[model samples]
Target: MATAPLKRWVKPEIYPLFLAVGTAVGLCGFAMARNLAANPDVRINKEDRAAGVLENYDEGKRYHDHAVRRYVSDAKPEIMPGINKYFSSSK
Candidate 1:
């Protein structure tokens, strides 16, 4: 004989309400995160930060770094041989 489950599942009407509430909570959380990201007082960048006990901090520098750009630009070009190379190079 088949046995009954330990617990009963939620009703269909209740499940939809739970789903909508969960989605609203998730959206609210995402909105808070986005707002926090835009706030300058909550700056969380570790890289390119001024090192000192009470040094002046600049958050704008984190957006663009010359060193990182230079490193990426220094990469050597790929050497693709044969007819494929000729067609690609023509573009």
Candidate 2:
């Protein structure tokens, strides 16, 4: 049996369109996943708030403060020296 010649695959000149569409779909999926993971009802109980259970409680503020302190402590060495130098040079 005689075999016919195989056609070469034609690459699209508008290949960037496909790449942009794929990137948009991936970003949308990532945003949806983030929204699902950060469901506020699960993180902060609305029922507890309605029942006055959290009226006297400061929810997560202490943790936030601690996190801020940690961040400031870690960042000071890198940030403050730059600021001081900038100010002194500007004087």
- TM-score winner: 2
How far in Å is the alpha carbon of 34 misplaced in model 2? Answer: 0.6
lDDT of 2 by residue, 1-91 (tens): 1333222332475578879989999999976775555433333456644764333334344433555487776564654787788877955
Which residue pairs overlap in candidate 2's backbone?
none
Q: Give the Å error, residue 3, model 1.
A: 9.4
Candidate 1 TM-score, true structure as reference:
0.34
Give me the candidate number with maximum lDDT. 1
